[model samples]
Target: MGVSVARTTVATKTGEVGGTLTNGLRVTLGIPYAAPPFGAARFREPQPAAPWDGVRDGTRFGPVAPQSAELPGAPAWRPGDEDVLTLNVWAPADAPGPLPVLFFLHGGAYTFGSSAQPDHDGAALARAGLVVVSCNYRVGFEGFGHVPGFPDNRGLLDQIAALEWVREHITAFGGDPAQVTLAGQSAGAGAVVCLMSSRRAAGLFRRAIVHSVPDATFSPDLAAGLARLVAEAAGVAPTAEGLLSASPQALVEASDRVVARYAADPDSGPLHYDTVIYGPVLDGALLTADPLDALAAGAGRGVDLLACHTTEEYRLMHQVGTMPPATTEEDLARFAAHWELPADLVDRYRTLMPGAPVLDVYLALAGDGFFAAHTARLAGAHARAGGRTRLSRFDRRRTRPDGTPVRAWHAADTPFALGTLDAAGVDFLTGGPADADDHALSRRMIRAWAAFATGGDPGWEPLDGATGAPVHVWAVPADRQEGPAPAHALWHDVRAVLRL
Candidate 1:
């Protein structure tokens, strides 16, 4: 009865062990409730795992889902493992019941990242008296291929499986499974939207927080074409038999390269929003309908929602390619030329940001186009759907590569949200702990998230049209507050009425 439960997952269905860490925090590692999703079972709905003979060793993490590029995280390689359909749990080991449950989905554009990264260690969040969970779902074609006979969204299914596991077993670890918050960033955010609309996800969790939902998607034809792209790249014949036999690495590379090529020039490239084919699509199943379409239709009216985006959404993207010599005025003009921006809007931006270089403008434009708008849309849709929505912008920048100060760039808020700032103390997704300024905001966010999970409100002003308070900006008190952004956030109206 005194066995410490450090790791619990769907792998073993339902069981518990506990342990006190050397640092005084309780930890739980790898406990499974679902069967492995490898070999012939791949591309299918998740199945429950078989029970083990004796107490399983959960001191370490389980194998993460299949991903081509391993971001700086979780146990990518593990002994005695293969399939990546596992999840990790961290708690105070013996934290009391009715604790808030926070289920985290790491972001990587649906391509890279695993639950194994140090950036996602939930022990800190758990110490906050909340139950924490991190999961690894299939990525790339293995996770989201619209092939002839394959499931359209393996990644989404993997998420559902993990949440379902939480529903069934989280209580064993002192978590209030009913009061569950499904939170994610980027593609993970997109998955939150999917979960909102999926009937399978109902009752699995109570509230949702979708951070920087990319709103990345494709049309049916485009999705089919992307399948073909994945097939051709994997050296498969677009037939089920062909792809079924393809190597995981080959498929992963094919998908990643295709996405990278298109992401290079999303507006000019094919499958990229205005360009060409890429990202999750509006398949008849899996998603039931496109999130934008569903949101407009009041599809997720019953779900509570909180959404946000970083101030500098494009800076993280700079890692993708080399920015030409720090961006000049001429460079900005060319970018505007390439994207065909409205003349007035370009002029307004030039006037609004006179001190910034052209490259910064372009990057800002990309951020708004890709991340900010989508977040706004999510909040607006939920508002129109008779659901309450709380919105925010993570304003604090990050530490530079050499430990300098960089403005809040893209993906900067993640480290704080996951409580991993120290482990990944870099610009991309790590930094110092909450200072008085950062802590004040993190307190609000953590509470809001917890409140939303328990109920529907995020403890902030509601985002109704009349209030005019579109979002709460996070920062220190004297300088940190919500609302009153640029003209775009003020002028543009995003309603979620049924379109389809």
Candidate 2:
């Protein structure tokens, strides 16, 4: 789609911004939500964007946050800049008044991702009669690295800043600030859950859609140990000044080395035999407690929530060769012991899968431990807290070019929900051309998401009790399903035991 030079301008509290009209939608890209977190500002809370003196051009995307060049099945890094605290907007050109806003946060494991990625285009969603916005925040060492004398979770603070910007400026672009729906996938979903528990972001958004939220949180001691390892890799002290002296890429490389070492020997680290080291930290100030505990205490009391996970979320990790294709019973038992899970859990999983392959059993156990378990717990907590909550499972399956079957994996619902199945740069996730059934499923997802953003039911009942209707399943032929309650029950106890 070629963008026509139909100049459109909107006035924000800071100043005016000029955008372009394309395909019946007005898009304003790279609007700064906060000042560049570089130099002395690194590792600190996000500061307000400096006001511009003239109408700023919003025609192209801003540089993404500096991150590692390595990613699974993605192109090489494009050398992003430190001044990357920016956002983009897509609003219907013909909407006369304030429309519901769908604010999105991209995901890359709190490590590598950018809003400028082609897969996150918001034009289709905008054309569906809603205003869509996407923002970029720090990731990896630059965002989550632990250092003395610096605040933790600065990346999350950057997101909070973007939400504040939306509350103060989205109205000028035909979006209702009060009707904002915060949505994300993977690491982004984790951020949304974190924000839901933050007092600073209490009324910033009225609704939330969390897709494939992984169970990862860094305890203070574990985070401190990881910080030391990163600093050792960089040949510097674990302080803000010591880290600032090194180049951003060097810091990223050092962080990667630390992660690899930890993954190789989970028993040697202060992480209690856990491999993954980066994510939201449990800082007492910004994040008082675990998100589940916060939700149970009514932190997200009034926010309508839609939390979902793919039926096979961990398949992507296995398919990309990052993880082994299969695991032994001994390895599974070790993992269960690491998480303090019961010894009989592996037997129970085998019973659940009856004659399944070792890989299938491993995927089931890993998926539940990492993604499904947390998602189910979050949904149940929200619903029990008197908050309107909906749970879903994405069962859409596809085949790879090599004839390998790829089930609905992590991030499979993004393009479908955004109505961008045909968009560029998503072939790896969606595989071959989408069939008729895929298109139909995409339409249903878009419609349901839009309906939920408008504060209406998404053609399903909210989660009542464990015995109520199963989660609204999204598949080639969409339908309501059951039988996940038992798995959820199992995980509920597991998470409680692990205090996750």
Candidate 3:
């Protein structure tokens, strides 16, 4: 496949940009949404990019935020690359007027990943009659770690700035800013819901599509404690002045060490299992409460909501050797007690999944407790608060010819939803080559996303003030609208049972 410069030039507030014509879309990459968040601006709010006199080349992606992650097909962070707050755009080359926009945020446990991931290609969605956009924000210590006398949740603030840029400049790229649908998965999904509750992000997007929302917010005290640990590992003071003296790489390495220490300690509490130390901090100004609590109190009632989670979200973590296994009764009991789960939770799971081994049961409980149940509860709370909300679950599963079972786990739904199942390196996520039926399912999911972005129903009923009832299940062969699972009742009071 060959690529050439686009004939059209889009003018933004900062400058004009020239992109490339690929397939049937005008694809632009590396448009700065905010200035470099380092040096004099380190740990402060994002600033506007300096205007350029001529058209800036938008042919390549910008640098990823300072982190240690090296995602396949995505640009990795390197020292001396200061420009990380950039965005990408994709619009149909021949589309006539302004189209609805689908703004996406990439997820990596709020620590890593970038919009430049191959699986995040928005060309398919652009061809589906929408302008697609994705951006990179701060992550890891630079984004979420606490510094004395500085703001928290700077990564989320960067997202808000990106949305502001979209609101002001998307029309030049053939997108209607007022018709934006903010979407994300995992940590990105968590950011979506957090923004929903943030008054600062109010009115920026008309709708939201969140998948696999994680319950990983930190109190001020916890965030401060984590920062102290990272600072100690880096041999720097925990204050803003001292932290600013440390290089981003040093902090990244230090954070990794802290995570390793937690993973090795059996009594390190919840961090021992997940090992992800960064997330949105509960600051009373930007984020006043938990997203679940905020949604229940009608924080984002004005925006439409669509939520989803895979049936076996945590299975991928265990299979990939990232999460520690709870194979024994003692391990399960310790996990339950550490996370403060209700005493009856494991017993309940045993009754629900009779004859299953301890590991399988533990995976089910951990997956639901961490992601699936929270996603369902978010939809329910949004609906009950008088917001237009819809819920779905991904249950696509198959066994390969070599007898490798492909359960719908973790990020398996992304390629399908984004129409990127055939993209490079997607086989690992989709469990190998997709068959014809898998392609058909991908088309259906893509169509559903386009429909929902256009403010229409996604070929299913929306949740109408019901708690986890009537969900659209995405699968091959046929999709179905079904009631909640037998275990849904136990998660109704998730805050009480799954306290992190």
Candidate 4:
């Protein structure tokens, strides 16, 4: 893990780029994969990168896409530029041959995340013996805003461009492009699902790892209506020309206001306010059909798949205050009704977890509806389509520095999988100071992930449709356990009733 202060350079198709070798890992940051999406290029498909002459320094991170400064516990708003189509790469400094690659996408509900987040550092994963990559794409109005005369889902197009770049240039950085695996969390996982169905993204990778894929897709009508709301907030017309005239900061603020309004009064619009406002649109050209529908039709026929969710994915929403804490029986009933859930759903949950706190009950229902159910369905579909699929449920709980308990909430497995439990913000999501047990769990997860990237088994059996081993549970004391638990069956039934 010794740091090599000397600069290292690699020749990519666009040009020679400089990087740094730190602790046995070479990291190249902020290499643009496409032309800047500014002015005329806004809301359009990503274009090829402008070739450079001399070696360009790629050691520093680039500015993220224009976005609101409203994330909880984040620092003061730092305005980013429109020219933010960049990516970062981490690979072993002295690998004898090109290693397998893992291309990751960051999740911010499709609106508010950047690859530059400290927790997303790929060095640890690279040290574990793979070429790890992360990229930044447009978000919010600049990425998903549906104005007239503009192509839809431009963010996804940016991702496709980055993947294509990897295909062309990763070998120079000691990565085997043919053995690539695409992995993501939350909205990023949703993007992976979308890409699995995208004709544009076919054969970009050989394997997929999707975590906590939320139910967030907007119909064209819903996207258009949301665009009008964003336009009105920015004091502009809903047309591309009118939106293009506004400042990037204005657009960010306008998108933030629209999100806030949706949070405050979720029922005010045709869209379901409970879901993310900005996400991949079911535009026929980019995304031919719903991801599930596409998967059912064997869209990702040859790809290996690993899909999973935490035991309590909804706690993150409650922790962030987007959803209220459920307390009374009346509160449970209200939540059920709000989501148009069947009346008997609450009683079913009560039966499933007798004497459980109302908050826990509510979390169970919401978690299944939002994450677990869809992920399970996606796994089943992939398995049915003759693809190798593995499923898991993370159940590790920890105490924060302040002694507050953090359950297996959304994203709790991220630090473990990345082998970055000591990183900042991990303590908040996964409690304080990871113990020996935590480190052991992290090693197991990292090993499994890296093994999967290497086209090897992850020390667990693939999900079996006939024998009913639907999920592998990851927890303390016991690293892995096969199960077709009653709770999972109950959740499947609940999701069926709610059509989630």
Candidate 5:
């Protein structure tokens, strides 16, 4: 695929926009999916973007949602940049007619991240015979913070609006709207499952791919309580008017303070371990039930689903220093108690991995608790509900030139799935540089994603709901595995005990 820079134009529902041609793909960025979610629209449901008079510039990525963290190769939030609810598109420059569409949502624990991330580049996926779309939705407090007299899950509403835009105008980009596949990672993955259960998002897409869905959601009361913390930290009331009085930057700072406080207090429960302050809120109207319960009840039976999680999902958090170390039995017990795991959970994990360090045991258990288990449960629920589902796990690992080991941690699968292992900042996740085998694994992963988006099958058999067997494990030399992980045998016991 020869790379070139050429102007390309596409007509959208809102207006005509120009994009750049590169690597045999047409890349359009920063097209508004909804009106700027600020000013009169702050903390409310999304509103449609005003139609432009002529061709709009879609050459640059939009500003990210209100966040304090700076990410690699992605735009950061500026105080006055309100046009955050935008979407981007990538399509084969010369598609025969209509191709499958893969709409993506980037993940940063739902508090940070943007579509402009280097690894999120959709050129490779577009070249693989899919029209790729990614969007910048509100994150942090602006997107999830609770306020009286306002709708909850405004970020999800932005996503629904973006999908609606794709359904209405994707044909102009040579995409088959009927074949749209909704895909996301981490918080983005959490949003994917939440949307799957949401009636407001029905018919927006035909398939769903979620990687490492977080085992987290907030009740209305919890959300409101967090909102008050932010409000008090920002020196304002908890009401909508008071919150609106504070700037996005103020709330971002305040949320960081709350996270720091939680991190310092071991008694703060799960938040003390993973201090993300926002997630999908279970409001009675928009989100009435837990996604797991909703899936078990046949909520998304009509959509094809593909789910994957890493073998060592929580390793990245520990490596990045966000998660505190669990070096002692007391530390491990504290973790189990914080997450409401069964009293014997620590002993069970120790039994599963004899001679392992307490930290390793804690990481394994925490990995399952936060990501792997939830992802597996989602597949089981969807399959049991009669949805076509394929389950997979990324188990690739390597030693860097310096002999530092890298496990297949939380997001180690994304660059491979998106065919961007060489993207900037990805080396830290994949370990040093990509070798021949790594590239081959990336190609296979990308193929599975493309195949799944085009058809229902992802080169693997659909999961057998009863046994949940035949999982496709993605590794250097990929292999098919039967039955769940050994530690997973205790998931039922743990979940029953915690009633999660």
Candidate 6:
């Protein structure tokens, strides 16, 4: 088919080409910058497309990189067979002067998610007087598999290509390419951290905000094992040929089953580690090391960092309609076997969160393991590395009518953060005004994100240069601030008890 030039400027994010939206804001989606992975391209590092002729159809969102959640034999990966590295953009109409570019990475444990989710509504954010762009890259086996002859982390390369796209073409959309800020939640948050830590990612973005990052780093051996198992399950040769011959449906199905295997373990579920289907790999190339390890060693290359989490980070997972019991002794044993975290941590977590059911303890342990403690450690490390960093905690917790405390769950900040508390897109975790505290706190956080993306300080107390006690309580009314610990931790001295 012939590529036609259109009114909007069609471009690539990283290496994927995207089309533009013809609405109020000059929006763009699904332009390809990389070759499709359907054939020999599978299991190899991403390769740039040789550029297209004519103005491509710079409009509409494209199919995601094959997700197993969509059901077997479904056309999960569609929208033409080529061009998987694409980005969507929303810029003000008749815009004047230089606008800042906000780049977003979608969250799905590095497995399932698309930048086109309505909740991430870039129109509102763009309407707030900024140029917003969301993007897609490879996920699962296609993105993370560690082929014997090829390097891993092809997905991250896709992100780099997208950022490069912003740097090269965002100016055409009325944005200042030099003033780009990378923003994402969950797996996307982990992507932000990866970009910051990568030496290859130097000068790609000026700022970053990561929400509830799920430890994206993995040992090469672990990644290899995951690839081998999944590749074999699909009846493929576990080599480049095997992957190329396997259909996206087969690959996605294998990935979903693997995710199911790890669903019982809360930490494993969020990290996408249980299935080992696909994720960032520490393969000695593209990625040099894990974020925690890299940051401590002063290897983040000095990207300004802003990190935060909801009051109750994991409650959303439980509220999920399909959520399973991610917390059981079986999970702990698996965790112990994997991380070598002394099998006692399973029982220890229970003691710390007394009076709660298995799910609560499961939630707490998963939260701490995935985000809470990491936030603390990352802030201190960034400070020690002489980089600008700030921290915040969403202190909005509500007692449900059922008398169950949902607190600030994983994505509780979205409705509040996007200023769409009653927006129609997400009716699962919440409906109506967030508990009184959430509404007030949401304003603080939303503004905080806007301000931090524009300036270094988030209008809150800077993290301690010494004591490391500077987790800003981001809630309504400055007089009452609280961090990530349980609401009644001081009353029962939860930390002290856990030490036992």
lDDT for predicted candidate 1 compared with the true structure: 0.67
Candidate 4 lowest-lDDT run of ten: 491-500
Mind giving the per-residue lDDT tens digits that candidate 6 earns over 275-362?
3346687777777877766876787636777877766776666565344554566754544455444455656766776777766766
TM-score for predicted model 4 compared with the true structure: 0.93
lDDT of 2 at 467: 52
Off by over 4 Å in 2: 1-5, 70-80, 265-275, 399-403, 483-485, 496-500
**lDDT of candidate 5?**
0.89
Worst lDDT 10-window in candidate 5? 491-500
Error of 1 at 14 (Å): 5.0
Q: Estimate each model's TM-score.
A: 0.85, 0.93, 0.98, 0.93, 0.97, 0.83
| TM-score, cand. 6 | 0.83
After the best TM-score superposition of candidate 1, give how far the Cα of residue 486 lies from its true spot, in angstroms: 2.4
Candidate 4 Cα misplacement greater than 4 A, ranges: 70-80, 266-275, 399-404, 466-470, 490-500
C-alpha RMSD for every candidate: 4.7, 2.6, 1.5, 2.7, 1.7, 6.0
Q: All candidates' lDDT scores?
A: 0.67, 0.81, 0.90, 0.82, 0.89, 0.66
Cα misplacement distance, residue 156 of candidate 2 (Å): 0.7
Q: Write the per-residue lDDT of candidate 2 for residues 167-215, one digit (tens) a residue.
A: 9898889999999999999899999999999997999999999998877
Q: What lDDT score is found at residue 486 in candidate 2?
A: 56
- lDDT per residue for candidate 1 within 1-500, as digits (tens), equals 35332333323344444333524345566666567777768667777776666566666676766665545544453323555677777766555557888899988878777777787788767766778888888776777776677767778887898898888887766788778888898888988988887776777877788889875765566667777877887788988888887777677667777655555653442233222233566777767777866876787777778888888777766754533223766655555555445545556766778877777666776677667766776677677777777888888654545987666666777766765556743434434454565655555666666566666676677787444365777664533445644734522543211110
Name the TM-score of candidate 1: 0.85
Residue 40, candidate 4: Cα error in Å is: 1.1
Q: What tens digits encode model 3's per-residue C-alpha lDDT throughout 1-500?
A: 67555455789988999888877788899999999999899998999999998888898898999989888777788988899999999998878888999999999998999998999999888889999999999999999999988999999999999999999999998899999999999999999999999999999999999999998898988899999999999999998888999999999999999998988988878788888889999989799999999999999999999899999999999988778999899999998888888899889999999999999998888899889988888889999999988899999999989997899999999999999988877999999999999999999989999999987577788796654667999988989888876776788775422222
